[model samples]
Target: MKDNFYLGVDVGSVSTNLVLIDEEKRVVASIYERTRGEPIAAVQRSLILLKEQMDRPFRVSGVGTTGSARTLSGVIVGADVVRNEITSHAVAALDLVPEARTIIEIGGQDSKIIILREGVVVDFAMNTVCAAGTGSFLDHQAQRLGIPIEEFGDIAMKAEKGAQIAGRCTVFAESDMIHKQQVGYPLEEIVYGLCEALVRNYLNNLAKGKDILPPVVFQGGVAANKGIRRAFEEALKCEVIVPDYFNVMGAIGAAILAKEKTKRTGKTNFKGFEAAEMNFSTSSFICQGCSNNCEIVKMKLEGETVAHWGGRCGRWEIGEVERIAKEQVLS
Candidate 1:
């Protein structure tokens, strides 16, 4: 555990992020890639890129896993610490702003609101069912209006008169946008209206019962959209701070978690850069061990079993592949 660097990976439905942080919890190497239907491959590619960027094969003192695909990733990379997105995000936020009261995060597919009390999570809510207020929905609307997504903020700012567009769901919002266009409403107005409507909807629905105090920090892919940032600022009537690494907050937080875990346990489980060069193969199978029928994924290297995950019964998780291989040899 002599090395001071830690590795963190956050693999979600839409994207895979890898971040390397030093002891100070500052990101040293960070890479984000689209999940592209293969979380494992995306992670491997990111790790390989990280390896190439480093001066040499350095010992990874600690490794952490987070996000929807975290369990699988933890098994694959021999994670030193496994944490959920909520913990990872909150930890990273506290590191940046020691007294942050509220956190607003919107990724490609989901959005969340976390309320903090003295740097601890008091309550939180997430909306994964609705896409109306999420980043991908905004991207679609920008495409339909023939405007670049990056310019969404500038257009919103210049909007003198805004139109009313439904923000209940994606279906209703798209139709409302079309109706506004049909009625000769300006694209900027419609865009601005949509932005406001989304923020309003998020506040009314998710942030309704929660106590949203000041010092709010917005982090996620949507935070890059100025229109959305302005919308949050105006809705909350407070200054919203967007961190320098807004999009990669989860990964950064995971790295921080890895660092903290290593310092506590004083152990390093990182497999090293040799893991990048390792010829790994992964495959999935439906486990009929129980009525749950979990879709277990297994990884192998050089014809030797490495890991198996995704079984609720733990039948396949207890060295089944290795024991089976040995049994095959004995037979």
Candidate 2:
């Protein structure tokens, strides 16, 4: 008998991650690819990679999506469940660390802090306005320092004393780093200092006024950096747990959610692996009905409207297209 698998996809501005899990919730295969500003193409490529490697025929029992491009991806793949980043992260964190009280997720473009009580999410905060505390900031600094990002954390670990860098903003931090470099500071020390600064900025911006308790789970692309993890541990004076699947936790969580939904409903709306080869078109139009002038995104699958979103009042949705068609017939 072919084993059943659940598929989860997370599409963000920086990267797209896809995960396939079996009946026991064990990860079967996962892929992480940079989005490069094209989410749909990235997902299609990832799916194609998954399809090409199938050793035996397996069923995709359910599908789910999360992240910034969740809606669009959901429409493309016919996802059974579509959720936000916070919910997905929290679900994955609690599943990994059942007693976790805090979650620090620093992705490519943004960062967030999720507070949980008794395994339930209570409060959360996000920092999207600043790039000083994100993975992109670290990538930029690594490039400037002439170091490979993979070796960045190991080099930081070698520094005995880190220089002080202003991390309130990316601009100030870069300038400070340059000054420290020009003054002949050790490369290791400067890199460690940048890690500390980013950690400080994240704590100050997102964890401010929130009771960040123990059993903190850190998951995201940045969590792979040992220097940043050490910085967080030193600052919080607590153990930070980074799961084995830290980089793809959001997708895992989405997959788990889809599994639960399928079990309850006994049905899945998954469009199947052939969706990887399907053509999809998306466009945006301004809604002229109200002063909000909301820009609505429309999705078409093979020349037929499948989904529409991004309206503030829900006036320009999939139903609106059907209504308009009916009105045209009446006229």
Candidate 3:
């Protein structure tokens, strides 16, 4: 008999990650790929790779989607469960460290802090308006310094002292870094300084009023950076645990949710691996039916509308008007 597995996908502006787990909750495979502004293509590529990597006969019993593009990914993959990044990240953290009280999740375009009390989310804050404290900002700096981002941490570790860099905004930080370089500041000092600045900015912004407790888990693409991890440990004055699969924790959490949902429902809505070959398209249009003029996003499969959202009211939903028109015509 083929084994049953659960699939989870996390789609964000920076990256897309997919993970497969068995009924025992052990990870079978995990794949991470850059999204590069095309979430649909990214997801399709992930699914194709996942299908090809199945070494043994298995059936995908359930599917889950999470991250910034969770809704769109869920629609494309026929997810059995859909969840937000914070919820998913917290779930993964609690699984890894049941005593975890705080979760620091910094992604590509944004960062978030989740406070948990007794394994339940009590409060959360997200920094989406600024890019200064995100992976993208670090990548930008790496490019400017002509250094590979993968080597950023190791280089920072070599610094004897970190130079001060403004962390209030991306522009200011860039300006400060350029000035530091012009003054003959060592590359390591500048790099570590940027890491400290980013950590400070994250705390000052997202963790403003919250009481951050220990047993904190830092899981995200940024968590892979040793410099950022060291900065967090220094600032927090405590150890910050980074999961083995830090970069894909959101997807792991989503897979866990899908497993639980499937257990409860006794069935899954998974569209199957064949979905990778299907023609999917998404478009947006302004709904003029109301003063809101909401820009609604619609998803189509083979030229047929399947799902749509983005309106305050349900007036622009995919089936609302179509269903009513069919009823009127029949009557």
For model 1, how does the per-residue alpha-carbon lDDT over 141-229 read when each residue is reduced to its tens digit?
Answer: 88988999889989998887568888878778889899989999987899998898888888988788898998999998889888778
Tens-place lDDT digits, model 2, residues 1-331:
8889999999998989999999888889899999998988999999988777678889999998999998888887888888889988998888889999999999999899999999999999988567778999999999988999999999999998678999998888989999999999999999999999999999888889999999999999999999999999999999999999999999999999889878877899988878888999889999899899999988889999888888887676655334533753775
Q: Which of candidates 1 and 2 reaches a greater TM-score?
A: 2
What TM-score number comes out for model 1? Answer: 0.89
Q: Report the C-alpha lDDT of model 3 over 1-331, residue by residue, as the tens digit.
A: 9998999999998999999988877889998999999999899999999888888889889999998888888888988788878888988889889989999999899899999999999999998578889998999999999999999999998987788999888889999999999999999999999999999999998899998999989999999999999899999999999999999999999999899878877998888877888999989999898898899998899999989888888675644334533653775
lDDT of 2 at 277: 88
lDDT for each candidate structure: 0.83, 0.90, 0.90
TM-score of each: 0.89, 0.93, 0.93
Candidate 2's C-alpha runs over 4 A off are 318-331
Clashes of 2: 0
Model 1 spans > 4 angstroms off: 1-3, 54-59, 318-331
Single out the weakest 10-residue window by summed lDDT for candidate 1.
319-328
Q: List the residue pairs that clash in candidate 1.
A: 153-227
Q: How accurate is candidate 3 locally (lDDT)?
A: 0.90
